[model samples]
Target: MSKTILVVDDSSSFRQVVSMALKGAGYDVVEAGDGKDALGKLDGRKINLIVSDVNMPVMDGISFVTAAKQLAAYKFTPVIMLTTESGDDMKAKGKAAGVKAWVVKPFQPPILLDAVAKLILP
Candidate 1:
């Protein structure tokens, strides 16, 4: 079965771009508008990975990841932070919240795919 990836971002266009890349790589993609919405998508489904944006209207990425890690069903799931925030402080917070990888915004699909490959186990 194809691995399922949950992609969370407020921007619809960004999610579409990421979904297109992930789908092209043979992965099933699930999209959410924000962290709260992404949390809803984590309803005991087999989510192999998560790609989230930091600056979102509802529940930011770090808070979302921290909350997600508390769930028994998703405690160990890997997370990748895809955002425009490149500050060390933000990255540090993400790492603390269990983000496995950090990809700055305006990223190429190939680069994002490479990060996904490293975090998303086969």
Candidate 2:
């Protein structure tokens, strides 16, 4: 079966871009508008990976990851932070929240795809 990836971002356009790329690469995608929405999406549906944006309304990425990690079903699921913020402090916070990879914004699809591939072993 194809792996499922949850993508959390405030931008609908960004989510669409990511969804298309993941779909093209033979993966299923679930999209959310923010951390709160993303949290609601963690419904024991076999999510293999997560790609999140740090800045969002309702709930931020780090807070969402931290909350998600506390859940029994998703504790060890790998997360990748795809955001415009690249500060050391922010990255540190994301690491604490169990983010496995960080990709800066305005990123190429291939670079994000590479990171996703490495984390999601076939």
Candidate 3:
């Protein structure tokens, strides 16, 4: 079966671009506007990975990763932070929150895809 990846970002355009790339690579994509929305989309569904943006309104990516790690269903699911913030502090926070990989914005689809391939659970 194809893996399912949740793409969480406030920008509709960003979500669209990520979705297109994941779908093209033969993976299923689920989209959410922010951390809260991403949590709502979980609903017992099988998600192999999550790609998120750090800065958002409702809930930020680090906070989302922290919350997601607490959930029994998703504790083991890997997260990739895709955002503009590349600060050491922010990366450290994400690492503490259980994020598996970090990808900066203006990213090439292929590069993100490679990370997804490496992190997505079987």
Give the whole-model CA lDDT for all candidates, comma-separated.
0.94, 0.95, 0.94
Ranking by lDDT: 2, 1, 3
- Provide TM-scores for the models: 0.98, 0.98, 0.98
Q: Give, for candidate 2, the lowest lDDT window spanning 10 residues.
A: 113-122
Residue-by-residue lDDT tens digits, candidate 1, 20-91: 999999999999999999999999989999999999997999999999999998998999999999999999
Clash pairs, candidate 2, are: none
What's the C-alpha lDDT at position 46 in model 1?
94
Candidate 3 Cα errors over 4 Å, as ranges? none
lDDT of 2 at 79: 97
lDDT of 2 by residue, 1-122 (tens): 99999999999999999999999999999999999999999998899999999999999999999999999999989999999999999999999889999999988999999999999845
lDDT of 3 by residue, 3-56 (tens): 999999999999999999999999999999999999998888999999999999
Strongest candidate by TM-score: 3
